[model samples]
Target: MQSLSGKTAVISGGAEGIGLALAKGLGALGMNIVLGDIEAKALARAQEIMTDLNIPHLAVEMDVSIRDDWQHTARAAQERFGDIHMLVNNAGVGGGMGALGNLDESGWRWAIDVNLMGVVYGADTFVPLMKGHGEDAWLINVASMAGMAGVPLAGSYTATKAAVVALTEAWSTELADSAIHVSVLAPAFVKTRIHQSHRNRQARYAPTTAPGPEVMKMAKGSAQAVENGIDPELLAKRVLEALDAKETYIFTHPKYRFVTDERSANIAKAFDSAAESPLVADVAEAPMALGFVDS
Candidate 1:
């Protein structure tokens, strides 16, 4: 999808951070924008930014995790711009910054709903529209390096992000024959307000359990990491380059690529052990049975 001029993009979490950076970058290329965010104040600020820049846009205050919200947002976007060409499922939260069992049920549920279900809802809502359009379309799901290299004390965040990465990979294959192209953005860290996400967390999802020292420490460290992270505009530029190349797995910070590589190596070693076992061939199903090609 080389040409973005005059195209329309729907970005969840478009009010700030990486999402807003992408909005600015894409709008610069003459694309119409639909900015959906849960924060009303931030959405208003984003709208002002769009108006100031003379970009074609509609800012919709909507929660990406809600299924009906997507329908409403779609209607608004289509009414304003018509035929969405890009969907960036970027709305997410930093949560469960502790060992898996330490956080209460609310923490887990909140993370699953926002971090994982948000992307699910976005894809379910937009993929059909994108397929109907013959022109080029792009689906960008923002994962994280934490998904690749699971960080301690962030069990929920890592799990949800890893799920997003897997979902993007599956959707990419499913949409391969269609006009919709998919890319999963996995960046190490970025200067964003994500660490302070609790400020916007809904009341229904408030925690019942008090976090332990480890959880508090994790939260503090995460805030520091975010403060020293790279500018989101740089990540946005990288995304554009990746989209131009139609790359499925968009990444940044090559110096940290070794982390994912190391994970891959560990996985391969385990697979090798299993494949070498004589019991493997006895129980293994044919590639066709697993919907896998025998290359």
Candidate 2:
């Protein structure tokens, strides 16, 4: 929709970080909010913040990875808000730090479950309601900058993001004729607790040992990069703008375009010369572990 005023929104992982930021932003725009998170304390804290802001909101303890959980969350949002206009599939976890080979099956699965499957569940659960309403609606899936490019270390994360991008593209095309609009947010970094998410991860996946020294060093750099990354409020604004524009691909920062542009140029040149880049092999070979498979 063009305006968020009086609209209803459900935000997965709304307890903290960018999720909470988007909730507050949408609330300030006069939207009714339903915030979901697995962490009770964080949910409570986020609710308190909403309360102080005089925003009408409800916090639900939810595990976005489960289909039943998403069903329940969708029902709860409709019950509380009367109608749902937006769904932000923002819940995600950093699986672990390592090369593709170093990432174990469990680690890979955990990342895919939360990062990829969570968004899938949210979209599959909410899109029907949005479509049924026959009103303007939006589905915003939070992918990552890594989703756009194959970074060296975060293999599992990149793979899941690629899935998200593909999903968003497919859904956007599929729903183009409908009132529901789909968009994917591929941000490089933002000041958030994603780095520490490894500590609070659920039982589905836990590395036996802490990230190795090399991994730790890379993670440190990544965290620092995020801390200096985009402002969450600004990102929130971009999200709303993307919804209004009906833009399928929502990118937060302009600086990140270099790699994407370089890759695109290479692809175009290869198309002209009948030669292709080897990046396809890396993408196809990246490990995909759904940590909750046995659960």
Candidate 3:
């Protein structure tokens, strides 16, 4: 997308926060905005904003966690806008908020379904559609800084985000031959409703037990952090600017680079020790002797 005008950009969770900001920004750029969200009221509000700005748009009430919902969104987008040039898998929920997860099976399932599998389903449904159009396309998956480095008391979130980063990186490489460019947005924190994500959690994903004091405290702290975080508008702006770079990894906050740098340094140090190990050399020589590996 060097020229986003007249193209279609479908964003999940586009009802509020960063998603909504992205919708507004892209809409302002003269692109057709398709807002996919689970909240009807938020969707209505978003549509109002789009209409007020005179931006061509469509609001679809759909849960990104459901595979069929993604298909529905795609069908609706195709019918309304024809070709989809951008897909932003931005729907996610904060879950298992405790060290090692103080959550039940339901909590775990909710996190994985909405955060991880949602992105997977979006890619599965939209890649072919974009490919068929024979035009350049973009896939931006929203992960967290926790994806770069584990955060204490946020095991489930960190795990899913890390998986998202891995998936996006691999897809970027695999899609290198195609015009579909993949990028993962890994931001530290933003002024979003993610801290209050429980409000929208489905009944099926309800926890068996109420949150303990520690979890409650963590939630309070998270709310504060979110309130103090960067504005979603700035994040949305960064995203649009980053799309031009066509980089595999994008970020809204560069102050958190140290976190990723420290993690990478530690992993490199550990790998160095492993490579020097006698057992590692023995396995390497065996592979070479068998001609299974290049010299």
Top TM-score model: 1
Worst 10 residues of 2 by lDDT: 285-294
lDDT of 2 by residue, 1-295 (tens): 4677888999999999999999998999999999999999999999999999999998999988788989888878888888898999999888766765465567778888988999989999989999998898889899988888787777878889888998998888778879887889998889888888876578867675455677878988988988898789889988878767777899888788996898899888877654355645334523545322232
The candidates, ranked best first by lDDT, are 1, 3, 2
Clash pairs, candidate 1, are: none
Please, what is the TM-score per model? 0.95, 0.89, 0.94
Tell me how many residue pairs clash in candidate 2.
5
List lDDT for all candidates, in order: 0.89, 0.85, 0.89
TM-score of 1: 0.95
Top candidate, metric lDDT? 1
Candidate 3 to truth, TM: 0.94
Tens-digit per-residue lDDT, 1-295, candidate 3: 4788999999999999989999988998999999999999999999999999999999999988899999999999999999999999999989767645455567778889999999999999999999898799999999999899887777778889999999998888678779999999998879989988988898888786566787779889888999999999999889888888877899888888899889899999998998889878445444354313353
* Tens-digit per-residue lDDT, 1-295, candidate 1: 4678899999999999999999999999999999999999999999999999999999999988799999999999999888999999999998656676666778778889999999999999999998887888899999999888778877888999999999988888778879898999999879999998987788888887888988888788879989999999999999998888888999887888899889999999998888888988467565585434556
Q: Please give the RMSD to the true structure for each candidate, in Å.
A: 2.0, 6.9, 3.0
Return the lDDT, model 2, position 270: 74
**Cα deviation of 96 in candidate 1 (Å)?**
2.4
By TM-score, the candidates rank as 1, 3, 2
| Candidate 3 clashing pairs, residues 3+ apart or interchain | none
CA shift of 273, model 1, Å: 1.7
